[model samples]
Target chain A: FATMAPSSSPVHLLFRQLFEKESSTYTYLLADLAHPDKPAVLVDPVDQTVDRDLNLVKQLGLKLIYAMNTHVHADHITGTGLIKKQMPNVRSLISRASCAKADIFVDPGEKIHVGNLLLEVRPTPGHTAGCVTYVTGEGEGQPYPRMAFTGDALLIRGCGRTDFQGGDAHELYKSVHTQIFSLPRETLLYPAHDYKGQTVTTVGEEILHNPRLSKDEESFNTIMENLGLAYPKMFDVAVPANMVCGIQDSHA
Target chain B: FATMAPSSSPVHLLFRQLFEKESSTYTYLLADLAHPDKPAVLVDPVDQTVDRDLNLVKQLGLKLIYAMNTHVHADHITGTGLIKKQMPNVRSLISRASCAKADIFVDPGEKIHVGNLLLEVRPTPGHTAGCVTYVTGEGEGQPYPRMAFTGDALLIRGCGRTDFQGGDAHELYKSVHTQIFSLPRETLLYPAHDYKGQTVTTVGEEILHNPRLSKDEESFNTIMENLGLAYPKMFDVAVPANMVCGIQDSHA
Candidate 1:
């Protein structure tokens, strides 16, 4: 009774979770099919899969209102710059704290509108300084409106590390608890990056089963700090490119 | 008497075949240990492995003289630029026909000397207009120098396609027969790239078993034209960057 999905059209909440193999990034395309224009929003577009994502949008005949990023990724170049170049009117959005130049600097508690749907921002930084989780459709009238685009802030059974650029374990814990875990227990969790092939989870599942962050804040800090991660191969290239919205650094 | 591979110093020919997983590329590192100063030459160092290669070079305490290429690749960025940046004295060498801006524009019959070893250029331009095989140790009074860096022109039981970038089937067939097959049957064939986990082959084995180019010229042309090859994904990004000697095309 809550789902606004029309009987005539099955694509009510038109959604696609696309994957780019190189960086293990998941790009989310959400469209409100109830509206005639089919206004859409894209999250975490990867530069390498620009054509792939654009083709999907074109095939769906959706007017892309915004191309958003959860954070300034250090693993792959973002497709925001390229998407804006392709779709002149599409606004590129990222957290104001990310320092990444985009068309719109989104802030915590801001709502990005696409047709009748709204994406609410919850600052869940820790993977990166500017990380945020985009929550949508949590009102009384939608059955499946509770979904979170949890950037690198939260993974299926894991959490983002606090070792790279501006990462802090304690802050991440607070952010996750107050911002993400505080959401409805059944809210679907969709992270920005996943390597283990597990795609979606829930806030309750993460709170109970997220091996890395389900522990105490101190333990989470210890684990995040001791990941012994090699600097990502694309770190040098991705960081600079992402700073300018995925444009490669010519000066480098 | 000719074989200077003494029992005391078994490092007569310091040889290592490295693999770059992203591009499925093979890099050959050859150093002549007979001389007091171990002069090293690297063929096809990939961009991602620059640090790894540099660390290896540092660990070995070897003086790198030349960073060469079999051809300008269309798969991965070359490490030539990074190598040059790290080792200012190292010369970057590729075929003059490649139009790649490098320190040395090597031509057919040119010998690149590294301590006591020499890399002789053999024009093998079937794979690409600028493709060339580097043959080392084909002269008298030299022991253990019968090896060929065949690039993509000749692979293990296969040959590169004559589909793009000035590729010519007839030229490739003739070049392989005269330049590569004319070498000693026992000559080791080290290709620039391989996919099936094949590390090395021999002139004798390839000449007899090379399914694509072993037949007559017409047969070779037929196979080359009908391979149904997809243009490499990195063609656009790699070609321009390789032309500038492996620098990433920041403008792209």
Candidate 2:
């Protein structure tokens, strides 16, 4: 029942999934572990945990070049602004479709590089007009099992509520099928929020088990429309703050 | 600033970290992805989350062979009994020193094999008399960055309280240094619980930043002794329940 792996490669990519409790948000710290310079990026960081994230960055001696957001969040403030203040060289990133201010606005098919790692930026809107999922892999060649940072576009056994902020059930459904489901079956999916404390999921599992996404288009739309979830408590405050990279208008 | 990873290995080991929010306990699910059988194991499962854990196991198409514990916990009950009740083939495992009822009594140097992945159990007592740390890697030659599942012997930037259940500060300190800290610098550490939302740490980071553990022996003991922590809310019920694999006298 036990055997040694015949072939293995040295781990060159550093991936750490950090959580923010107040918002149940996941902030990813990705770095090039093989490179001495240790270039890194933080995806979808929350405002409250900025200190912890930065401390981790410093402890690891990483040069964080980007604090990126998958989209404008309606749940909690982004840590991008706070991070930028502490580490001025760290640029803010967001999707161009987001209509939000950021240091760099990316579009579909753009490639984000952190040292030896590659994050293929693919547009996966519908939960919001601006949401994008970041997939890891060198686009054309090398069929490594990739990981997708699917913000709110897709969740574990569920999808995001498409009731507000330019929400559309049809768009969300189409986006997941075309962009996310098209990835390799073994691709690991990491979402921004998980209220149930689950950390990661695979594309294969989601296609088979995701309750909402697995349904027919009509049934999926019906399920989305009838979720009856209440208005998000932080929607008003978080959306405006996140618009300017999580710095409130008064402060900005 | 970006370069393709020179070499890479196909991922054959499946690792997922699940959480139970009530007590901040972490349950890990590990499997062999390269094997056709997909043999798997669950480490430190919680009682209330058994349904979710089993559901995940089913969804992943994994053959759960073992439900193991690092030690008998004082915070929350274990899901071993319930899981046994559901999956008759799955055996319950615990350290022999725990003096707890389990189908398999593992020792300090025992290797628990789940398909191709191997968990080399190493004694890491101090948080409790039976605490153990499971390190993953072939025992020799393979210099791969391993992972240590260090129950409460270590937490992110902190160590567990050594006040009860045969807890000892000195023993805990020596165990962490000799067993966990001795691993490769990049070896990732996953604890049984985390009060903060932090998920993983590395030996290098913990060595430099762990508050209590980074200190000399005397300072460490002083910090642990004067934590002034209140009695655990679920200690009385949980400890006894866990002594019999989380099934109470009435249930048994």
Candidate 3:
């Protein structure tokens, strides 16, 4: 539907996509207009990029309110715990189903408030039991939120595997078809990790071209079973640290 | 003259070059074939690459005995502290002139013994107050040492900046010429960091091709002063952490 956006829209929302190349992770910063100091959320902040992220926040004159994650990561340590130390008031949030402790436990069908913006959280588990999709704005309403932070549940042309942690192919397949594909065909998808330099994909494009998920149930499950994915290099350190929201030690 | 390297050369040292792309830093691992389990020294291990360094040691089935740094680094945290934790027997080493704390403080003209392999330490300051060049071999003649680990004092074709942390252009010029260049013309030079992919350079090549240091003191100082280099991103965290051998906290 967005064949051509308005020449300019003051209410379009502030968004920035930052890349931490070490782990191929993308961190997103979002804020509503009219309040430069209040950025509603940050998604998937990596540990090594904490300084970079903090500098970006300062550069944009944002008071970061939420340092959140879609799920516990396995490739790199999360910056959630560290960000809290810097932004003391910013809540570190993760899905309660993850059972990975955080300052705030969010669940499906919840609304996260940031200034005039509202992120509707939808549980899109399958990559991990706690994976989530954060949708910005109201799809059919006056606000017209068209973007979705799909975490690791869905990528540009491929979906995350069901091999590590509590990943399940059946749950993942059902989740994508139900919660994600049900969104308006125009909704934009932003995945957590993209090694291939792909940035964004529209719901319509993914529905028509997503090879893994666009197939039948048996074919999708079989494909997930045979991906033969390699465990991440820093899994030993990343998972445990991410469980506590990126705290490397007990003192944190 | 390596016209034909011997099939069974006991005196030959096994060398591997590892790159940590985050900081464009290169860490070298050297092990003498005579006593593989005795002493293997690692140069410039980055904190994030600790696991990688240790894994390389294990993969080669060699025992690590020393973690050495030519000078305190500014770009990335050193893995010396973390390496000590993993390889309890590995001694942390640095130039005594550095005044930086380490398990072993080496001095100029001293010999760092690794089985039959002898690494002669030569004071090569100026990039930092306590930089040193380690020339592997030639303590007892036969199998002449032709390699010098010049650290940041002498890069492939350019020397390090003399702007921060007690860097001196004049001192660096003299040090490179006297301590590093004075080595055998065939001496192989290994640097601490390389932004480009170029790895090893011979002293003979550097003398002719080094753009920054192959000139008189007045011209060298003038060029150094006008380079206008940027401060490293991890300067604060890295310098302090490296001083303490990459220890981020009490737990480390």
Candidate 4:
């Protein structure tokens, strides 16, 4: 059986995976192409690429509805605030647990929709206390295979570092096992950042090959503890700015 | 009308857009997931990222039948030769007009198929005499709106520099106007490279917004001539290596 409906289906969804070079972040643009208005949502947008992203949304004639973050990022500022400023009609969204400023704050199990397309928010806090995975195909029956936008919780072949931002390796391991891995084996997993050029991975691939998360919980926690990673260069500037949806002092 | 079939269709195609950071080149992986064996093809692979590409193919349990190039790239070494060397069963492919060494040389109007998915070759030479665009959804009632893998001939809001490697402004103008702009308005265009992190654009969007291509032929040519862009940093090493399918002196 096919994992998702064909592009010719009655209710087709338009999807694009955009990249931010500076932070190696992946932002996703999605909408119901079948809808008359083409209402769209952007997930994990970076502040630096706001112009490029907004221009694209305009070029495609998509109505920008939401600029959302999977978590409060420490590596790069979120584009949500900047986006809302330029387009006041646009709303900023973040997990309620994130304690961040946004027009809309969602909690675990909440369903966010633009047209018929939906994102089911699942808390997957590991890399950060408020990180969440946005899984597609929630609510009634959506034929598409679920896609997990695993913010910093799960990465390709690796999980995010759990050294700061209230990160807990144990929680992350549990989150992935319960919320992400349990999806259908074909569920496509897109991470927020990738140092390598890889764009996407699948649940089956990660289950069999994820170097860190595939290990037992104890080993996974131990691995996360000894990563010896450096503090993120942009942490100081990014976190505070992102706390208020990336407006920073300039907005004041 | 939807641009392509939805993902759940009986003959759903699996697609992933991979990036190479140094050159901002985009490599596309395509396969017919509906086929039991899942034969796959990679377009415009880069040598520096061959390991990641091959590993992905293996991870997906895809049998990669061909490694092809849209043109002999001047910006980076083509991964075709290296890919074939690693997977002997995989054939290297390039355009016959490109004067490049490859196991399979395709010409305009030819169709290459892996399972039921197809790429209809369209000569889009401009950046170079051999450049071609691989357009999907060709032949016999393929319901998907066509997608053009336009290599350097047309980029998002831009076109490739027409200053070297047999570059010709006039030819590019004519090629895109006749072969690309004429496609269905909703057809998606995937370029070989994008520096600004854009993943894709539709025919309608590019037709109206491409700064150079949207202008008259004479004006377009003038702009191309005056780009004043620096010669590509990799031109010296990339051109010769790409000519022989990216296996440098070491491959011998």
Candidate 5:
């Protein structure tokens, strides 16, 4: 019912389809060609699975302007380097707080401009110390940012675990309460991974019903303790792989 | 409630825990001192995760003997090489018909002596091409297989996807109906991974009531289609990794 909005610009905004691979890591490409350059952004791409992303970019005839990672991933390899390797002109960006070295370290309050769209970086460090959410739209006095890219910080029915490196449950609580849940009810929520079948959700819906973050602190701690998820086997490999913009060194 | 068994040998059995850094692949070591001079058999070993496996073997005061892979994995990297590296005296054994290359190939009807136990290899290639289940018990006339390492062929309340390489619904039908179902119903089913809060199941229970495999062919196809799982991202990496016994050239 909320998918009734028409593009504000007559040039048309085309969002190439985005989805997760077998590992449940979500990747997205957003583009608007109304302006001169027709810039686009690739979000949370997975390593070695860049063929689809590249193919989509070519089919859409859009210029790759920015490649961004929401945070370091635990389950799969990141594709930040692969994109930059294929598209040399695109800038690779990640949060400054993230321990991984990046070409462009983004500040929490910094604004990134691509074509006419503006992405406001909101440091939401609960799932990990460097976790961030990209709010898309006009930073001030505009209803444009209709969506947010929430990496491991949030999910449709749950939130990211705070047991990994630099992960803190308390920080996650603050992030959801202050930064993410503060968004407008109509804002669309797009996460980096969704193990469940559903892909997207609304800010209002998540704020009111997210199983982990919406509950009291006691319940939240209990949930975290009871998760019992085995440490991802690839964590050691994936963390370092993502540190340098998702590049897999031929030699480990 | 089915974990009742009686044994006469004073053999000390040790289990070593090896974790895959990618896709959380877990390899285990089960050894018995009764056959100290002979080689021990490794189960579901991953490529890079063998340090702990070897360390545990030495710490338990046993010698390395053999390596075994339950099936070609689609999730984590394999560790067959690491085992060989640590103990060159150890011979790697896998299903003879499996796509993997091994030092020693085992047939379905063949049985290997491990300490006081007899290990029987059962060709249950439904989860992947050459997938096999290992049944271990003491003595030749044992009434039941004390333990069954089912790999991905049979999971509690679920079955492996019949969509990947060598994954065939019809083949899975036969594997479940004729091969695995014929085993003693009381045999313990030990799967490779379990994410749904389940750790174990029995052969009798699965054969009698598994919702997916127990259904007729038409219903099974519809269920597989509707499940709509994407192909694993690690399929390419995992296949190649498992091919040479989970070893990738450091420079690969």
Candidate 6:
């Protein structure tokens, strides 16, 4: 027997697809094609994973409205420029405090509207100088953010190392304690990359149990001291790649 | 105000050096060369680290007697062949079960002499098909094996993933259960690679609490299944490099 089911109400879908590049870095595409305009946001997008994102957008009849980077990643190459090149109308947004060059320099408290979705830029500058988490919700006077794109600033069971450019453990401590951890406990924490196989977590969960960040000052100092040795494999390649918006010249 | 006179048993000389290549691998050399005939073993020796090994051997007036692989590595390239080329008198030994070719296939049951030092080979093939652990002591019948050079089988707090060639979880269980775990609790475990900032650990510590291996069969299976998603970046470059005993032609 064949079965057919119909929904009573239209689903306001908001979901993400993970794309792992190199071994450790993860990029994501968050789409909401329920609206006729079908605007989508690309977060921490990788250079090699652009085709998959493009194909998915075309298949779902979604318009790529925004391409954003949570931070200048040191693990894998970014694809912000490539997407902008392909979708000329799409806006390339990055934290204004970040040293990276982009089309739209978003301030910390500024809000951006993409179709029916609203994103508030929140600066989280521990992992990199201009790291930011994109808070997503429906635009309203009392909007409650349901999801946060936490780049490399925070992870599932751990946090990003603070040994690279503008990486300050003490600053990271402040970023987590005052900025991220202050958010709603149930807000889903979607990091750009997670090597432990965990796709998502919550800010409250991280505050209570993150092995690296949930520690006393002395213990945090010890962890940070030891963390000096954990260097990324793609630092040399990814830094240069992210600088030009993930552009690969003929030599590359 | 003068410092207490030093003991007559020499200065207990200790020398340490590191080899950094491709920004991913760190090859180390440690030796007590107070004695002219001091015998030394290369740890996690890479093909490019050969020149430093040769320099140390010459400067110390010591004989290069053993070249070792922690395991058939899947990350950085190996240096077994290059060392053999430079020091033909030195013996190239690894676990007989390792699929890679070696000049002298070592059986775990046998003990070999290197000047006044004794080295025992232990089969521990969890990371790859033919991995081995080299235990060092003063003599063949030494009461305790002091140092263990674990190739890729085990790390400080974590165990290698069993998803690559000859990487069977059952075999890893057997290898860890019988071969490595059976050693004295204090026996120092020195791994081939450590990205977590730890340089060494003890077998007793690992067997009792290694997050990856010290678990039930179901948990072990779950971890291994999850690890299958992210394969090593150097697997393609490393297999061919190791097959030819770590040699890399310019084209390669």
- In order of listing, the candidates' clash counts read 1, 0, 0, 15, 15, 4
Reference-based lDDT, residue B251, model 1: 45
lDDT agreement with native, every candidate? 0.80, 0.87, 0.80, 0.86, 0.72, 0.67
Q: Which candidate leads in TM-score?
A: 2
Model 1 ranges off by over 4 Å: A1-252, B1-11, B139-145, B247-252
Stronger candidate by lDDT (4 vs 6):
4
lDDT of 3 at A6: 27
lDDT tens digits, residues B35-93, model 4?
A: 66798999999988999999988877899999999998999998987887898999889
In model 5, the runs with Cα more than 4 Å from the true position are: A1-12, A139-145, A250-252, B1-252
Error of 3 at B13 (Å): 1.4
Q: Which residue pairs clash within candidate 2?
A: none
Greater-lDDT candidate between 1 and 4: 4
**Which whole-number lDDT from 0 to 100 does residue B56 have in model 3?**
54
True contacts kept of 6: 0.00
Span of 10 residues, lowest total lDDT, candidate 3 chain A? A1-10
- Per-residue accuracy of model 1 over A1-252 as CA lDDT, tens digit each: 245443323335666676676777889989987778899988999887888678767855789999989998888889988888778899888999999988889899998777767788899877788998999856643336388999988887787777878998888899999999998886888888766434567787678778887899888877887889887898898888888875453344
lDDT of 3 by residue, B1-252 (tens): 244333223454666666677787878888775553545889988887888678757755688888999899988888998888877888889998987889899989998877557788998889898899888866443244367888899997788888988899889999999998887876778889766444566787678768888788899999999998887789998888888765555473
Show model 3 residue runs off by greater than 4 Å: A1-252, B1-10, B36-38, B139-145
A67-127: candidate 3 lDDT, tens digit per residue: 9999999889999988888778888899999889898999899988776567789998888
Instruction: List, residue by residue over A1-252, the lDDT tens digit for candidate 5.
Output: 134332334333444324544677668787766655677888888775687677657755689887899998887887777787778887788999997877888998898776656678999997999999998764432334377899989887688988987998888888877888898876778888765434566677676667788898888888887898888888888888888776565343
Q: Of all true interface contacts, what fraction is found in model 3?
A: 0.00
lDDT-superior candidate, 4 or 5? 4
Q: How many angstroms is residue A179 displaced in model 5 relative to the true structure, after the best TM-score fit?
A: 0.8
